[model samples]
Target chain A: MEFTVQDKGHYTEVAANGRLNMVAAPKLRKVVDEVVNGGGKRIVVNLADTSFMDSSGLGALIGCLKLARQSGGDLRIAAVQPQVTMVLELTSMNRVLTPHATAGEAFGND
Target chain B: MTDILARRTLEEPAAEQAIEDLHVLLEQLWLDAAFVPAPDQMAFTTAVIEAASNVVQHGVPTEGATLLLGVELTVAVERLRAVISEIGAAPLDPVPDLAGPSDLPGPDDDALLEDYDESGRGLSMIRALVTTVTVEREGDTNVWVLSRDSGQG
Candidate 1:
């Protein structure tokens, strides 16, 4: 998986592409921690380019959400594809993380 | 020829795509077997995928290790049986005990999620989806055997 991070002062956005399975889960966790540790707690993860995801990937996202929340901010997701969304919904994470249609919407800037 | 598909000594990194390929292969086998509603086939597929993922993540060497995955199919009058085997190092103890929905991390807890982060929940998911999950040891190699019956449906 390839991840690119964008920091815009108040919030951070992580754009991820490729499969988010066991091999990539740890890397994603590290990214989430980096964002929180850098004091960029409000996070928007853009999954527009992610093609596949599994339960481990979901777990990582949930962990990130927990971290962001603990730090007095929130983590939101945007532009998730159908397949990834299916896993999230089946696992009932959609209700917890609350995906938005766009990054700007998740950031409440639009 | 009776339907049979075999992939032997499958390396760890190749397991994920191999699982996808096995799905297709099992579908073709179903067609040849002339049976519908083969729950065992689906269970076998899920179990093998989970086993392969486990081997990839835990059993093989982090740098370079080889694991063997073999699948064989047999069709009888009222049953379709698949045998899946993997040879590798024994997985870590306390194999994931998957928590039910009620046991999930609460909306407020972050520590529990982090504590179990590296464990093998995939294997637990597989066990939940299948009828039987077993492990055996032969010399230094560990073998996982998984089976499911059509009656499970």
Candidate 2:
């Protein structure tokens, strides 16, 4: 899996490209941690290319969310694929890390 | 006997790499059996990955034995199935609870989300995706048989 963090002025967009499974879960946390620690508070995880995400991946996202919140910011997700969406809903995490329609829109209203 | 339409089998040391490799095998099996719908393919793939990940993450190897991840994926006209085994592993001390929902906070229950169970979500997900799932101990292996009905109207 590949991860790219781009500063979009309003919020940092962290794009995850590939399966976000057990193997790639920790990598995601590391990327998001870097964003949060590097003065990028408002973050949007772009999952447009992430085809799959198991529980491990979900946990990583939740962990990132907490880290962001504790720092007086928030983490959001956008462009979730079908499989990833199913996981979010099935695990009932959709409410916590809501999926925005697009990365550009994640922080648009804030 | 049921004639298998398409099948893929993989066996390796139950490690992180094995999960990645088995995902590739799943894609290959779907390519060979294109008759399965996209939704079925996605759901089945997720379930299989979760089960296999469970073995790698939680399965304990017996004394002086190496845990191996063994997977057998089979696709037929009306079904998609996989037998994921934890080879040379110790028996599950407290077998997984596949009957009811495990301890996952509701989507809107943000307060309880802080206490979410790490391992429970995967098993719950497998239960939600497959038509039927069963796990048992045979000799030294813990086998997970997962089947999903495909192309059902």
Candidate 3:
């Protein structure tokens, strides 16, 4: 899995391209942690290219959301593909980390 | 006769690469059995991946030997099935609890959503996705059989 972090003016957009499974779960946490620790508050994880995600990947996203919130910021997800959407809706984490339509619109209203 | 419309199998070291390869194997199986609906395919694929990932992540090697992952996927007219084998692995202690809650976590369970348990969730997710799942120890292998009735919506 490859993760690219682009510092959007209002938020940091992290594009995760590839399967977001156990192998890539920890990397996601690390990327999001770096963003939060570096003071990049509002975050959007772009999952348009993420084709698959297991429970480990879901756990990492939940953990990232908490880490961002605890730092007085917020973490959101955007551009979820079909497989990723299934995992989120199945696990019901979709309620907590609701997927925005697109990365550009993630923190747009805020 | 339970005719298998399509089948794919893989055996390799129980590692991350095995999971990736197993995914490709699934796609190959689907290509031949396009009669199965997308929803069934999506759910079954997710469950299969979860089971395979469990072996790669948690399967203990007996006597410090290398653990191997073996998978057999079959798509029949009525069902989708996968047998994931944990070869050269130690016995699973306190077998998985599959009868756990499969309900969608409600807004009331916000706290539960925050600190999600990765391992346990995989089992629960598998149970929810597939029609039936069973784990058995066969010699030096722990085999997980996941089956989904493709007839359902």
> Over the stretch B84-143, how does candidate 3's per-residue lDDT look in tens digits?
999999999988876666745545557676557888788889999999999999999999
Tell me how far the alpha carbon of residue B49 in candidate 2 is from the true structure, in angstroms, after superposition: 0.2
- For candidate 3, give the lDDT of residue A74: 93
Clashes of each: 0, 0, 0
Evaluate residue A62 in candidate 3 and report its C-alpha lDDT on the 0 to 100 scale: 88
Leading candidate by DockQ? 3
For residues A62-91, write the lDDT of model 3, one tens digit per residue: 889889989999998999988888888887
Clashing pairs in 3: none
Which 10-residue window in model 1 chain B sums to the lowest lDDT? B4-13
Q: Candidate 2: deviation at residue A23, Å?
A: 0.6
User: Where does candidate 2 stray beyond 4 Å?
Assistant: B101-107
With candidate 3 superimposed using the best TM-score fit, by how many Å does residue B136's alpha carbon deviate from the native?
0.8
Tell me the TM-score of model 3: 0.95
Tens digits of lDDT, candidate 1, B25-92: 65566666545354455445444555665655566432344665555555554444545545444443
TM-score of each: 0.61, 0.95, 0.95
